[model samples]
Target: MGLLLKTLFYSSGFIIVWAMVGYPLSLKLIDRLYKGEQLKKDYSIQPTVTVMVVAHNEEKVILEKMNNILELDYPQEKIEFLVSSDNSTDRTNEIVTKFIKEHNERRIRLFEVILRKGKTNAQNEAQKTVTTEYLVMTDANAMMDKNSIKELMAAFTSNNIAYVTGRLSIVNQYVNEVSISESRYWDNDLAAREIEGRIQTITAGNGAIYACRTSDYYDFNPIQCHDSAMPLFYALQGKRAICNHDAIAYEKAGEVIKDEFNRKVRMSRIILKHILPDINILNIFKYRWFSYFYFGHRTCRYLLWLSHLIVFVTNVFLIKESWLYAVTFTAQVLFYLLGIIRGVTKANNKQLTMIYYYCMTIAAQWVGVYNTLTERTKPFWEKAESTR
Candidate 1:
């Protein structure tokens, strides 16, 4: 029993530490070894494209988003806008209608759903109405740069590339501990995507700003996350999904920790319920490099909470065996205790706050997994208030 507990403690601790630190370091090293060069942008090849914005009660930001789309550097004649409203009770549909009437020449079209389905369902319906060679899908709240589309389209210089996702920047106006931690997380995520793109292809796309070939687009399961599902589909079809760092979109980070935790919980359920069932993705022998990276970068991330929990429980059992184990066990307890203190006091220590946020996020994932197993979680969509 003692040997078994010690072995489990060391193994789980190693996985947790590797995922937290070694994974990012390894990406940086691999990027340097197999550096990739970007293809030259060809301004002459202007293909017709459709910009799809999936919205649900987004009246506050719809008008600004329309203006942003109209002001894009891409040719207006070649661009078509499709804004889908998922049975929004608010003035979201009216706002989109008004925009379409005002900008008739911009080719802006609106699709409304009487029954409220999720964003994925709305997007799946919108794809059927597209009449362009390329499709760009973005969130209604994401304010895109003038040259975002231009940069995204530039990556399609090769027919082998199926999709290209832009960088999503989280700009926090009222900076708090949660916002600071989230900003750092996104920066590291962007770096990972860029490195993965250089090595082979990115594991997933950012729905905030991503473009794909219209011919390659497929209807996604309404319950699945389009950002993850679409890129995985492209990979299965033997096509490349790369990140275009120059193409940028901006949105605010969640100001509240609870809101962020709920969002992660929702995403965790989606990954477990929908993503994991796709057995073809786990067949590493067939996909080779993509499968290796997908398991290491994405699968490991989703299972991190399990490893964290295992390390904690096993450390408790092994603390009496050695001083090293005792020290580790003490450190874990202290870290979590500090997290609890910060949570209760609403303190502003950056390092301590991040530790608290990480612990809470893991707890959220565990709750998500439990809810998923018990069939307590639903596929309904609710926009995070703080992010808006």
Candidate 2:
């Protein structure tokens, strides 16, 4: 029992400390990379790029999305469009077929796959369908900014660029319930900005709203969190995943609090399925100060929250050092309860609200570990159902 408690204390303490230490290191690393040196100068030639969209039961919105792409200023010949329905039971197929037939003369080419390979498989299959040198993946619900593709292509000038992520703007936040719901839950606009401004890392990748080279395409595990996993994988390999703030895509946000919560939980599951134990030293150098900061600033910090829960629970009855264990466990529970109260109030102070939000986020992470461990698979995509 003493040995077990010792292990728990040491493990939790290490996680907490490591999470804090990683921040300053990441900042120093990012500073070095940003010093008068740009990697985009290497890709001298503009290469062929393909646009891929994965949709499931997006009958009402797919047509409008296709139209938006057609309005892009890029030469249709240099850019291609590939969209897959992934076993959609709605009129999604019919809508796509009509667009293909009507716009066959244009540079747009449409293909449909009926199998439900999840988002990752759909993206992989889309990559296989095209031999283009570059590939951009956008969501069916997202509408790209007029110059988004153009700006993204400009960044490829840096030869070291593997994957590029864009900004996602929730369209019409004024009155839409979905937009309002998103502003409070699931959406990471401010968090994304903080990451970009401080560490140059954007966690969202705006989902299907970003562009990357076909060669950099990685066949990640199907259930893995696509956005976070892909960028982190490349970043770990010592390449910077440039976050393009100017390149924007407008999409509908979650319509209700429940919808938003479900999206977060689904995303939480995906994240747990993917975060690996391996630590990359190259990632430390490539991102430099910011990378270290980000790992500490974001990634490692959350892991500590998970450790806190495990440690608190184990120390309760397993440790003979009752006073010390009780004190630590009590502190953890109190902080968590305070976070929950702050999160529930939804106050107007953005800073305090964000603090609450971050705390709740860690709480959600704990839930993720539990769900992942207990073999729970909430079948339907939570956010998608509302979008439908």
Report backbone clashes per prediction.
0, 16
TM-score against truth, every candidate: 0.95, 0.75
Off by over 4 Å in 2: 1-45, 172-204, 270-275, 281-294, 301-305, 308-360, 377-382, 385-388
- Tens digits of per-residue lDDT for model 1, 177-276: 8998888888888888887776667887787999988888888767677678877788888888899889999998889988889888887775574435
Model 2 / residue 142 / CA error / Å = 0.9
Candidate 2's displacement at residue 36, Å, is: 7.3
User: Any residue pairs clashing in model 1, and if so which?
Assistant: none
> What TM-score should be assigned to candidate 1?
0.95
What are the runs in model 1 whose C-alpha is more than 4 Å off? 273-285
